[model samples]
Target: MTTTSHSNRDLRDEIRDYWSDRAATFDNDPGHKISAGAELFAWANLFRRHLGAANGRSLLDLASGTGEIALLCKELGFAVTGLDWAEPMLERARSKAPEVTFLQADAERTMLPDASFDVIVTRHLVWTLIDPKAAFAEWRRLLKPGGKILIVDGDFVSRNWLTRMIERFSGSTSHGMVSRHQDIVARVYFNRGARSEAVASLLLEAGFENLRIDNRLSAIHRAQAHLFSWRKSLLRRSEHRYAISASAPMTTKE
Candidate 1:
């Protein structure tokens, strides 16, 4: 699949359709859902530890498929809004968490009001962005002064020959979105080598401050390898994943 052959609109539509098709079974995937009680507790604790007090904080869960993180935030007492482009995915999210607002919008170009959210969270989303820098800017614009953006992502495609061989065999057993769109995976800019420093720099360029990378999420994933084994099995899977946090500067009121 040559990127040159497809227009930007075409690529966007393909991505939307790809995610829409996977919406029905998305939560069924072990890595995507917090099904077990222990897993749920661990994830809740992780969010609490990072996000601090959730009371009165407004959270925007970008690319919030099936309301996983959004629902979690709602449960934690934060006013939550789930945003995604795929209607089918939003539909599932709405079904699961009707109390939380779910909007169908582009993550890179949300027409939402500036500085509206106290916190922004996204998981497994950055790699799919056509322009991560632009997306970061948009996210920064959406955050309130002192607001934080938490991202969970990793480099999924840049790998050695042995890893590629392993992925090929692993993908054969998984039916996730990454496995079905190997071509898109190869073309994604972030998949090339989106390191932590590079992403932090992008955030800084977008006017975000106090950048930090948390490896606890990665450690949890590593401990429960089977929980995310499907991701590794995918042809376009990340070798490692971590969480990044950056805060919008506090505005000075004259």
Candidate 2:
């Protein structure tokens, strides 16, 4: 398939179309869910531990495809809202968890109220976004003071020749092959490299503070990944460095 060079809007359109096409089969794909493994389980356990407890808080799951992460948060005692652009994905999420709220909305331009959520979680959505810097700014804007944001996604662990062959052979065995392969291409197009420092810098540019990168694999998840957790701080310099222009408002922390 030929991918045209795209501007930001063009990229968003492509992503929206791509997800819309695959929305029905989104969950069944091996790429969507984490499989069982000691490393994955331990990682999830650690992630939960780091999150403290959801306990009656409100969570906004941005780009929540099948509501898996949102449901997890809901199970942890959060009143959860699953938001995504694809209607079919929301439908599937609602079917799986009728009690939770699932809304069709763009991750970059959601119709959600400002400063509404206590926690914002996005799984594998960053790579799908055309303007992640803007998305992160929006995530910061939607969060209450000191609210937490967790982004769980892949990282560049060196791929060996054998790994490549195994991955190629295993492609037919998983749905994630398509989504993830596309993501790798997109990442290379958007960011020159996949490094914690590069991701952290982008977060900082988007006004996220106290950035931390957590890389832990356990038996509970299928993908070995990297997670970035950051807090919004209530401080500012005279001028925002990464803002699009002087007209754009600086994101107020909290």
Give residue 93's error in model 2 in angstroms: 0.3
lDDT of 1 by residue, 1-254 (tens): 47664765677788888889989888877678765566667777777767888986999999998888898889888999999999999999998898999999888889999989999999888878888888999998899999988887776656877677775676354556556688666666675766667777888898888888876764345445556555454433345567788899998989
Worst 10 residues of 2 by lDDT: 230-239
In angstroms, give how far residue 185 of model 1 lies from its true place: 2.0
**lDDT string, candidate 2, 32-142, tens digits:** 654445434554565475566777888888898887777777766888999988887888889878999998888988967888887788776665556677777888888
Cand. 2 TM to true fold: 0.72
Model 1 score (lDDT): 0.80
lDDT against the true structure, per candidate, is 0.80, 0.63
lDDT of 1 at 212: 84
lDDT of 1 at 211: 86
